[model samples]
Target chain A: MTTDTTTQGTALADEIREGAGAVVLDQVAKSFRGPTGVKMVVRDLSLSIRPGEFFSLLGPSGCGKTTTLRMIAGLEKVDSGRIFLGGVDATDLPAHARNVNTVFQNYALFPHLSVFDNVAYGLHRQHVPKAELRHRVMEALALVHMDGFAMHRPQQLSGGQQQRIALARSIVTRPSVLLLDEPLAALDLKLRESMQEELKRLQRELQLTFVFVTHDQAEAFAMSDRVAVMEGGNLVQVGSPEELYLRPATRFVTTFVGRANFIPASLVEGFSASSPDEVASRQLSESPDGEESVGAEPSIFVRPERLRLEIGDSSGQIKGPRVRGTVADKTFSGGQTIVRVKINDDVELSVTCDSASNEARDASIGGAAAVTWQPSDATLLDR
Target chain B: MLGRGLRGFVALSYVWFALWFIAPSAIMLIYAFGHTAGLTQKGLVNLNHLGLGNFWQALKYPSGPVLVASLENAVVATALCGVIAYPVAYFIARKLGPRTRAIVLLLVVLPFWTDYLLRMLGWRIFLSPLGLLYNGMQAVGWHVNYLSILDTRGAVMIGLVYNYLPLFILPLAVVLERIDPLLLQAADDLGAKPWTIFRTITFPISMAGVVAGTVLVFVPMLGDYVTPTLMGGARGLMIGSLVASEFTEGQNWSLGAAMAILLVVILVGIVAACWLLATGVRYVLARARERALARVLVTT
Candidate 1:
């Protein structure tokens, strides 16, 4: 919370003077000198990562997520902002002086050092006691399941093994925040899946704050306690994966997070006018903590899975907004079946039902179809 | 796995090598195994008495001390060149743009355009008492009354380093340029200072270049004929001049050829010893790591 009055502002600031968060970015900005002109990579971004929290910065390529991670690790300097690591201002610190470490995208392990020496690099820099350094390095290696590779050179290891060593090397120092910059992007699907679970377990066991950078939404949503969605050098939304998926704050978030079925402005106005109080109450109940305004305007939005499809008179008994149309197409995808309903020439809606459900079995191409969704599942895309 | 055309080219090169290099070296080898007989054929060899006598004779008396002095010059010159070349190579490879790097490399090899003997003669003139360097220092008002390093081993060392420095820089720079910049960043991220990164990562990775450059300069210095003759005078005599004197004035072609063979054996022996030492050190390091890991494994 913030106050405009000087006295209250000072009081509020003093109370949390120790640290507001484990890692805090106060309006960070970065720009690169492009061939054409100065190109803004990240602009006016403010965020706070909680202690022991597994946080992720999720975005497409060139969306400033990796740049944000680099700035946090002090590998890249901020154009105009402040970064705090464990309550200390780390904005002016060089990379080596910062208490944070990163697992690079390519896992840039030292080619000359053995696995043990690479993992022990940070501890050696700190002049940690020789015995303690060895114990900790072995401990870190064991955490990554690479204990047997202590004497092997990085060149002799496989990609997966090298990835484990890079992870071990970064975490050996027990930094304030362990930053991972697309650390699993190069792995194959099977290795990436297992590494995802391994990373989740490591975070939980270590109880260390993790700032993971990734472009894959599924990967970020599956592992992070909180996720920040970035687009065009700005923070679009920051929330739990469930919140971002269910209560997307912007049009970009609505489309980027999941597949969406839209009820046009023409249809939305009719239902919104007839049931104004109902829409307001549904919005309030879904976000009871006063995030209703975050969805600024009532825009009829529904996720494909939430759109219930029925074959006949059973649709009339449904307890929500309903529409009748002809089934345009249908597809069976093992676990679920998707049916396309043509409401009019200009409007069509996709509805998903359980593959073995009676509704899916009953729906036929060119036949009459009914679509309805629960009021609570309705979302208003912010204008 | 060479292509058809490349295989042809390789075969052609081998033929050229055999004709130009192998034939001459083989003749010298035969001379090294034979003894000289009769005053009329003193400069020529007598093939009847084939033995290691010439090799032993090459190592005896005045020749032995000259061989040692030659080795000393090679060692000193190679070390100085390596030390001077590393930083220049590192700066060009790691810090400069490709365009700037090419320019600097051109400057490094600029002196090689001149003739080798002309360069040695140039140095001899430059280090003379009334040379350009002495006058330049005097013009700068240095508090010196005398300047004479012309006929000394120091002047010969300078010539050796100046002549071979480009050889060392080119190879070291090539290897340094090939190192991934990401490794340096990784080191910095892992809390290593700049110097620590260079010591632990950069330097060790460029060792191939260091060894190659050492052989490039040291091997040539062992048989150098011009620099010591021009600058080493009498006291700084080297094995190369001794061998030259034997062939020209002493008319002992057998002893001269044998000296060349002895140099070859010593060079090969030194290379083998170094290779063995490197292997032994690597083995020791691996064993020490195992023991350290075992101790930690027990404790934890």
Candidate 2:
């Protein structure tokens, strides 16, 4: 009997999901009037979030990440463009009318309400049957491991507990798309890490699409199935974490996603020494000939972890281009130690190695060293 | 050493309280219980003739009506202030930007720059038979008689409301502004309509301000003599004017002291009743909610 009801519930939910539709942003733009005059917070941005997928909008502060999330939730109005939710235009819909919910950065739980009432707020708004509301609220609380805290007021709970209740409150309504605006930003490091895992697990278990916004790259990369990187009100790149880290399309994406060492292509042997703009034009001009076009004014980007450090002439055994430099600085951070090498008076490259590695342990500041990496590991981009 | 310092501080505070509060109250108590011996001196009282005659006289028909009328006028004025101030306070707190909020708040307190007596006298002139309001009303072809509305209960109530409106708005604005905007956004995200959000969240959270503004206005308006004296002519007699008469015109210090003590007791009782009522209502509502929750849980 229980199995039968569960299946029926899911079937009903699936029908509802079909009616709810995926979130589509059609060239949305938003701006705010400030003392300095009207400033564009979000430029013409278009993106679509798939149903039941963990999508993230990642960027630094003032990068329009939060604004985009708010726009999707209908808390913000687009200056131009239409938003479609569940295939229905929701650009003009008030926040209360949209079938989307947001877990705010500060949790934003009602301090005047108990955990149970907070979770059941949306249900009450829809006039859900009391018994069903209670059941669903308890279930949501249990999902966040806060079932026993239903009677407690939000202020009585710790920060992590409050965040859980916030999650429970947003999810209890079973919104088609849940928007989390840095929900774990206020938590300490350890709590944030654990909550990130919990949030991902909850998203999967509930089978709900999530659109998370955060400036912390690691937090966004860890949980999102696909991440959209934004900068200066424009969408820079959108891809999976590995795809973005390995092949960043722009210099901002390359540095924002993770640490990358950018070396002038002229410094690498065998590449023609030319200005970045000259190389770009050359590559553009040769591109119509059906030949592989090398980047103009090309700069090589290699992840610090991929760079190998050797104490002596190990270029013969190395399979890629090598650079001779002296160690300028070494920093030991629990699991890994970062060594900065000065290749020239104007250039410095960082190499990260495991703390337990013999090369990292033997490396001394001001000592001569050589850094090498495979050609495939180095990404060539127009400077 | 710390304990000795704390003890010293407490003793100093007690001395200050006795000098400022207790000594005057003690003198009043003595006068309320004693009698004056046929105008031998203005401030002298005979301890040997101590009795309840003054209390009896103060509680008689005329004084009783004065107290009742004063209470009625204060209650009506306070209610009016509350109804009118809430929207203004809410607007200033929620709708205005920081710069505008500061300016509005300053305007709310601007009347305080003038003396209270001067403001009441100004009202007396404004509401007089030939005053601005009377002439303006006549000019609008209302055929209303000039100066007729002055010195009436309505005039007294208006004066009280105008005088205490600022007191009501300040505390209400303070409490309303302290509420986080994020909570309102969260409520909207939870699918609460505007009215429901206000009813369930805003109203309940701002109750503290309502009660605080009420007490601040009510307690002071109850004992106000200036507005009633200036605006309330023959018909607007109140406990404050009656009490003043006993001391100044009647030269019955003992009777005035007794009446003043009675007013204090009444105000204290009103305050206590308000507090108890608020707590009782909260308790009952909480119990009802718990019962509702219990029923839902059992049924599920």
Candidate 3:
């Protein structure tokens, strides 16, 4: 692709478009030699990020999310298999040779260089003309709204400003793919939230694929077009935010993506097929006759928000399966009240209710209530 | 109000400084400006007579050449020490693990356990005509001319480098160790190759160590007398040895004091030069900071 180097914005956009590619990992594995022995950090990890997509690798720390991102950035070598960038094998390429950039978790700004110089570093490496380098650097700084602080050293800037400069530095090169290893992990919550929006905007405007690694599921979900959930060096699930939240494939995903209540399958009767009222009424009739058949297999995973609490014996009218429980604990958390319900001696479920609702106000510790949820609201997963 | 014990301690230290340092310096200053008595007075006994005659005689052709040679030797030795110490420091700081780094640093400083006089004596034996080094070279089938090797300028350079190498390495290692490895990784991620990273990031940051190590090695080398006296036979007439000879063999105490004063002035000039260079760097950085602040203000 021929790019005009005269106009700065067009040049940058053209460079990104030409370099941007879908990153494909084919059966990649990485291991590190720890003090004890060899420990596997990532095992047979494989995923494809499409061009211009904001893909997130989400997991707890030590789950190999960062390692996987590093391998793609060529910061870490794959023990086996290959990585492809723009449909070319880049498995053996050094970090500098790869058309990839990373915004480090610590921001890692060169304390010796000014903000302008730091941002212009990548272009300088490319040996671009000085005037063009300045133009592109200024363009990047302006994009991050840091044009005024060009001459300031990285140490002089705040944490959030340093993060912005880091982003500008990485993106100024217009690499094929940008890897962000928990770039917002160091910022405060408010700044992180705003930077999340800014990152999303930049990804869209640049049209470059972004592979973001973060343990913060909310941040990942808020920013990603597709989220890959990892656990113990393996990819558990990859899907849209809503799909993963509503129809999680595993117990790990159910708990990791959001708060979930896992109930034994034996306690939930006809959880997959019947409504709460039907199951509750059938259970009530069976209880009078002293005959209750709790099914086996398929544990139920229900989000706290999906489970509702109603005072007194209101099981007959509830639309989903209902279970009788006493409110073990009730916490008023400003906007929502979290009520912990004990259904049996060993079974406890959390139900979230809006604080403004009468049900939340009525939920007092030691008071009797029925927890109900539609069969469709709960995901049935084999342990 | 100071405590009684603290006051006493302070007073004692001041008295010690006056007795040891100030008294000697004041006497030397007075002697440096005094005239050397002739055969009748015998050995600069005319202390009551003071003038600029001794300084003028010391700054003449012969003494001036000796001073210049001494300075040249010091400068070359210090430069060589800096060049040789940096890689050793980098290896210890960046490449080795903590235990190994500690061991290596210990080995580098092991020479300090021996007395300075003993170490120079050891070098003198090693570089002698029938020394172990000559026999070892002969065993290796290399015909090294032993006669030309010992008590030469080369020997003096070697002795100076050997003595001050640890001093140069320690500070450089400390500075290099404190650099965050993350910065290099960040530079790599920014498309900087290894050489470029070293040029742009590593070298510039380690400059403080370079300056500090230079001063550490150079300052002592300027006034070093024993190394040249032992290793530099005929060509080793440095200012320090010259002063020593004047005080002892020549018995020209006034001339020795004058030469000592000149050496002190030159050393002070060097220190002032280093200070100016450091302040110049700080001034540039401060100006850059001010410019940045100005730009920030204009934009706001």
Candidate 4:
């Protein structure tokens, strides 16, 4: 490697292929010496990401999602864990030595360099040929649709343009795994939505593994192939967006993923399985009386969109478990109005209805109604 | 669009500057153009005949050489300060912990609060024949000669560097500290080695501080007279000492005024020359980069 500089530089420029850019973290933990003392930020987090997958670490701030991402990027060291990139142990490797790159928050594009130079930075570091560097750099800029602003400085571009340049710079190296630390957080709402779609498109087209870190759960749901929700330095749950949304495992996961109405209840005896099949079968076989007969207390979680409201003079049969309550409050949000139904002693369940519907418009506060939801929609969760 | 109170403040500051700076400059200009009185006690300057003779005289053989030497000394001293202060500033800005950084900065500034003349005197004692440094060096088995070292250009250079180092470090440190560390982290993420990151990002951004610290040390060093007077016996004499002697011992205030104006001219000329040279170099490099990029673009 030391004999031929040009060959070595080109040799290091291996692009991540489709099935080789897997990232694995084994019992990774991190701690910081805070003002108080040594405080743990990430505790025993272990997960394996598939190749060409869009993975997200979703959590609130200070929950160590960013720390975990940094550890994988080799920007932050894991206290005691092994990180494997492309089947190579990279725990002790520095950020530059690892086959990875990061798109930072606020798009830390070099203010001194033009957009073209910035996108060419990783290529330059690999000492790629000048013609190829230019071709690939322009190719990346074209990918982000920022080819027109290649001559402009990073400071001269707007926030969205800078973001595009940042994206181009990160992907120019074709690293094994691209780490994104809240890269879309600094943009405005409309821009954020468009960029989210753009990012999803880019990830699919590139077939590169993307490790996205964000606190916004909705953004994770919109972009990830799999999301690992974290809380208090612990991996609370990991599943697909639909699986996690429908079958939340804990009280935190229930409330954090979506707006959920939780009812205090208990599981029936002899339902020991935790798989989806067991949950669905139990939902079909059990009656509402079984919830009252159980000794142990648990919470039944249901999303607001799953509940249907029946007003006075309804001739239709209630086929599922229903809660009899009076309408406590009605909030008229555009497209959807949330009507809070107060049932049996202070348990208020919010049922979302279309704002343009006759029932939503005619529903009055304190009116008697029955809020019915399918038993399959509710998940018995642990606190 | 200015508020009334701010307008008043602006007016008052201008008046203060005119009274303190412009008035003295006008008096100096008058003396530069006039001549010294020989016998007629019509003040120190004879206003009957005013010419460019004094300016020419000041720009000629004796004072001309002294001014050139002074410029050389100031240039070397300023360069040395920049080299020595850059690493110190970088260490304090980037490497030290937050708690230690404040302490180090305080130590850097602590010398500024002490008496300047006393510090020069301390350097004088250290460089003397029987001083602690001379004996300490002798004890280390090097038969060094302090008889030649004392009252030399080397001693004066030391005094200048020691006296003006804080000025170089303070502004440079402030600028280096203000550089976003996130940029360096980004570079590291983008496959930059530590030295490469420093070369591409840290050093270029720190050029602002380099220029500021250079000016802070260089301009004042040109106007300094005390260090050369105390440490420079005769061979190390600077233009400042010549100007000082002309005004005091020689009592030729007209000649002194002319020398002062000429010194100002030389300072401005050197700065403008450097600015032009830097601009030319920057333009050439930028053109080369653009041409290289254009070549690549054509090939692509």
TM-score of model number 2: 0.90
Instruction: Provide the overall lDDT of each model, using Cα atoms, as 2-decimal numbers.
Output: 0.83, 0.84, 0.85, 0.84
Best by DockQ: 4
How does residue B105 of candidate 2 score in lDDT?
A: 100
Write one digit per residue (lDDT tens) for candidate 1, span B118-164: 88888877878888888889999875666778778888888889988
Q: Candidate 2 falls in which docking quality class?
A: medium
User: For residues A202-263, what per-residue lDDT tens digits would candidate 2 score against the true structure?
Assistant: 77666778899999999999999999999999999999999999889899999999999977
lDDT of residue B263 for candidate 2: 92
Model 1 C-alpha RMSD to native = 7.8
For candidate 4, lDDT tens digit of each residue in A233-288?
99999999998898777788888889998776544455421212233334533433
Which ranges in model 1 have alpha carbons more than 4 Å from their true place?
A1-21, A262-300, A309-333, A337-351, A357-383, B37-44, B143-146, B230-237, B244-251
Candidates 1 and 4 compared by TM-score, better number: 4
Query: How many angstroms is residue B271 displaced in model 2 relative to the true structure, after the best TM-score fit?
Result: 1.3
Which tens-of-lDDT digit does each residue in A1-383 have in candidate 3? 01222244454667688764799999999999999999999999888889989999999999999999889888888999899999999999999999999999999898888898899889999999865676677778877888778888899999999999999999998898999999998889999999999999788778889999999999999999999999999999999999999888788999999999876554344323222334644433232112224453445667999988888666456665687879999888999999999888767999999999989988888988988876557665654
Q: Which is the better candidate, 1 or 3, if ranked by TM-score?
A: 3
Please estimate how well model 4 matches the true structure, expressed as its whole-model Cα lDDT.
0.84
Best by TM-score: 4
